[model samples]
Target chain A: MKASEISVGQTFEKVVVEDLKRTQLVMYSGASGDYNPLHTDDLYCKEAAGYPGVFAHGMLTMGMTGTLVTDLFGAENVRKYGVRFTNQVWPGDTLTATATVQDIRDEDGRPVAEIGIETVNQDGKTVVLGSATGLLED
Target chain B: MSDEKTVTFPVEGTHVMMFARSIGDYNPAYHDPGKGEGNPVGAQVAPPTFPQAVAQFDPEYPLRIKDGEAWFGSGGSPSGIEGKPATSGGLHAEQHFEYTRPVRPGDVLTARYSQGETWEKESRRAGKLTFTERLVDYYDQDGNHVCRARGVGVRTERPVDQG
Candidate 1:
């Protein structure tokens, strides 16, 4: 995104995932190589781990939330992206991610946009909160 | 507490595409290089969180199941290993990434990991929480710094209360 095209308080949002599937969690585990049974093993999660069932990996949630950030500031434009996991995400939960421009300023003589990010599940509970700095187009 | 743990990661287009698909990101820059001519990075680039995939290359990564090893997850039984805590592996609390430049396909990255910090907290849902931090620095084949990843993991004294 261009500096001239964006302004403080501007927001971008997207339904990153709808009715999240356990299969997608498996796909994430396979692709990201995070084979944590808490995410992929239904038997372990219930009988062994005492959870409802398999849940999404924290990195998977963070990565899903990052789609909004990368959509606004291209993957290459992002200089920094950080997040704190606030809640667990399970299958059948829909997630929406929002990114709001917090500030437009210069960092080391380069224009940058400071943005705030959040991902909320269908119940409106936050699953992730974060911020990012994206280099603006000259 | 810092120890020298290194992993070699080879950035490949197919891997990047699979990762992008997993996250529901269909950006052409991560999938088809020929279609990314308008990409600002001038090339196909990996996603911001791609560095976390370095765990795949770490020989000692605990999350992955190694052949002939006693796995923590279940097969026929609830767990393959006995007397292990339900939350033994812990949970990711936070993750941060700073990039000097975008990672591109064909870039062989050497990542070095070290422990960062440790702290404790008391929570109603999770009881005593011990948090540990880890830092990883990634360098390209030419030895140029590519990215720095910092992660925080929390181990709870017991299974976190849903309520």
Candidate 2:
């Protein structure tokens, strides 16, 4: 699957927000060994931190985006994937991810395609926005 | 909390490669030391998931709460949060990462992490849901900016209400 094969400006079937919640924070903290209180403490998250509640991890949202790209272009063909946290995502918010063909360039003269991606919640708020570059395998 | 002391580690090729392998990613760019057609730059490049392995410490690191102000104590869920026992199992909910540069072999990497944010919400079955974000930053040997990675995890209150 080469990027050249897919039409430019192709869009994936949008994924609806499903089973969104904040429970995974502990497991992720255990797995990644990251124990930041800003993410786990309730009183800290509320009275002290002033967040609506515990919020979803930004990386968790980014990983969902990676899964989307992997589904579209397969994991092996993905060369580079990245995203910036634009807005915070909360449990129960529906998110939609869309990508647009940005350009095709040669990485050291090798064929590569760049796609701009934006993940927006049901409120039409962009939670994550960034670009991903993939090498088209012949 | 802004003046919290931080811990740092100088990353080496071995650590990066090991982290990649631990994550089950075996990209040649992460394993091979030679450059060629298969080897894009002739030096092993750390896999994208490798950055999460670096360790950092923050005094105010948020404690995973099972209930109220107590931190989850059991190694695994179904035990308890801080003190109160849990009623359900935990599931991986999501992740996000941003890379400034690809980590290459021999590039000394340093990482620091801290608690970013925490929120709680209602769940139909679990009673409550919690989400936490961890901020990770990576730097090169020359002190050049490398990458910033963030991981989000969700913990539930009930076993049947897993995500």
User: Second chain TM-score per prediction?
Assistant: 0.95, 0.65
Candidate 2 overall Cα lDDT vs. reference? 0.57
- The deviation in Å at residue A71 for candidate 2 is 2.9
Candidate 1 local lDDT, A93-113, one digit each (tens): 999999999999998899999
Error of 1 at A47 (Å): 1.1
lDDT of 1 by residue, B1-163 (tens): 5657888889998999999999988988898876662374467888999989888888898999898889999987989998888786899999999999988899999998989999999999989999999999999999999999999999998888888
Report the error of model 1 at residue A131, Å: 0.2
Chain A vs. true chain A, TM-score per candidate?
0.97, 0.83
Can you write out model 2's per-residue Cα lDDT over A1-138, one digit (the tens) per residue?
Answer: 464576667666456345464555554444344555444555544443334455665655665555555445444446667776666667677677887777777786777777888899887888878777766665
What TM-score fits each model?
0.97, 0.52
What docking grade applies to model 1?
Answer: medium
Best by TM-score: 1
> Candidate 1 at residue A5, lDDT?
98
